[model samples]
Target: MTTTLTTPTTTGPSRARRVAALARGETRLLLRNRTAVVNSVLLPLLLVAAVPAMDLGGDVPLGPQLLSTAVGVTLVFLTYYNLVSTYVARREDLVLQRMRTGELTAPEVLLGTAVPSLLISLGQVVVVAVGVAVLGEWSAPVEYLLPLVAVLLGTAVMTVLAAASTLFTRTPESAQITTLPLMVATTSLSGLLYPISSFPDWLSTVARLLPVTPVIELLQLGLAGRTWDGEVVDAGGAWAAAPLPLAVLAGWLVIGGVAARGFRWAPRR
Candidate 1:
């Protein structure tokens, strides 16, 4: 008599289980990395607090400027830097590749990885907003709620952009170099250091076209109770100083989506 051996089949983890596992692992990794933790959390808080004291020497209220500055820093540290570093580390370690082979879809893996960072950012925003409101006497109008939406949308766009950028990054060390262009360009053009309105006409025109411009405008408008009067005109002239936050953000979303589709989880063969 001949006996045949049966191979056992393994089932993948549930969606919830996979997400939880991914989040836990990512959190642990983030905690162990001292520089990542400091850059992601501590530096942003310091910048937010420090900006209010800076001598802009302008008539603008410190509250509004601080709010805008805080938002910019949050986006940079939480979304852009965090995503780039995390993606690079995961890619180099084959975590992304392993996740892709599991039950988790590409979108699921990306979203799952971003969940922890998103939570951290949301918490930071709450703390900063409360502190500013109490210390800076900030009183935003109800209609200004739109800027919060812009922040959320912008963060999502940046997260996807980070993932797309990682396709070109081979290791975590290279992420620092690859991220410089985006960090510098966005920080300068996004009104982090100074208001774009103060820039030269030509420079302001270029700033408006950048990805972070609309978000900053939205935040400033919300915080300052300013109206969009069509003063700033883009090359297309379609935005026209309007609350084009949704439109501009949607454009970035589309670009990021296309890039994500083209992104590779593993090194090219």
Candidate 2:
């Protein structure tokens, strides 16, 4: 008679516990990088501080514009760009590979690594909102849910985009170059700083498809109850107009998700 021996399965920490532990470690590393501290945290806030100085002119409300721009800045610099550097650094250091060899799920690993950046992004949102309220005399958002949704979805999109971006970035330093195209496009063409309507018709149509454009568009509608072309919208109309931009964001999320699935945990040979 032949007998087979089986090994029992063992469970480790809960997903939340595991992720939190990783986040704590990453937060410490992030704080140690003074350049990242300034670039990822300070620079975006500084840019948001400058938003109010823009001569946007006419009926364009400074409050919505400022808040929307702040959201975009947070998404780009604080979340997306910072995460690209983090992922690349960790991958090169073999941290991601070592983590994957353990009990942590891939999602948990990525999410944990992303926790600090996400927190900073959310904190900046609060800071910007309060600044607009107290200083800019900004009224509360017309449909608060829409702007909230915009930020949440935008964060997810940026997170995945950052992961996908690592495919081309061989090192942490090269991340700056690899990330520049999307950064520039989102800032310049996504209507974060300037209105997309100001672009020529074809260019505006193209710009509308960018990952961050829908985010800014959603914020504009939610905060100001105004459509992208400056049309005043009621609460109902604001939500009604949401599906198109939401679909656009969803598309980018799907695309980024696919690309990120191919992300390499180990450094290139």
Candidate 3:
């Protein structure tokens, strides 16, 4: 008679515990990067300080514009660009791949990686609110839900886009270069740093095509209380009336999701 021996598999930490642990570790690493903290957290606050000086007599109030721009930079720096570098580093170091082979589901892995960034992003939002209130009168947005929606949607979109961006990013070092194009486009053209309403119709039309424009516009609507009466100013501000509100943002999220499906999870051999 022949007997067969079987080995039982052991489970890892509970889902909540696993995610929390990953987030704690990731947060530590994230904080250890002093340059990241300074650039992502401090620089945006500095920009907020400068926003007041750049008002230059606009229809949009300086307070709302400054607050919106400040918050927008936080989202980009903490959520979007930060994730690109984080994901690339993790993937290169095989952290992501190892997690994939464990008890962590793909969603869990993604959530774990994003936990630190999201927390930092949320904290910065509060800081912006309080700082703006302290510096100037803080009137809540007329469309309150829109700003929250903008933050939620923007965070999700940027997270997915960051993952997708890793497909072409060979190493963590090259992330800055690959990320620069989108960063510049979104910060400059998506109405994050300035109002697209102030732009020419032709320029606004082009800016609206950018993935981040809808989120930025929603942010302006939410944080800056900016709403156009579908009235186009010059030839460049057509983006003000574009069909890129929630619909456009959702579309970009889908695009990012699709793009991430093709990502290489392991470092190239």
What's each prediction's TM-score? 0.82, 0.91, 0.84
Candidate 1 lDDT over 68-181, as tens digits, reads 667777677677777877777776677878877676767667777887787777667776777677675576542456567768778888887887787777777788888889
Best candidate, lDDT: 2
Q: Show model 3 residue runs off by greater than 4 Å.
A: 1-14, 56-58, 228-243
lDDT of 3 by residue, 1-269 (tens): 11111222334557678889899999899889898677667765776566556763335556666666665676676687778888888888889888777777665677788898888878777776777777774765655667677778878888888888887888878988998898898888777655676789999888876767776666556545555322313212333433467787788889998887776667876
**TM-score attained by model 1:** 0.82
Ranking according to TM-score, highest score first? 2, 3, 1
Tell me the whole-model lDDT of each prediction, alpha carbons only: 0.68, 0.84, 0.71
For candidate 1, which ten residues in a row score worst on lDDT? 1-10
Question: How far off is model 3, as Cα RMSD?
Answer: 7.4
For candidate 1, list the clashing residue pairs, or say none. none
For lDDT, candidate 1 versus 2, the one ahead is: 2
- Candidate 2: misplaced stretches above 4 Å? 1-13, 39-41, 44-52
**Which has the better lDDT: candidate 1, or candidate 3?**
3
lDDT of 2 by residue, 190-214 (tens): 8776788888999989999999999
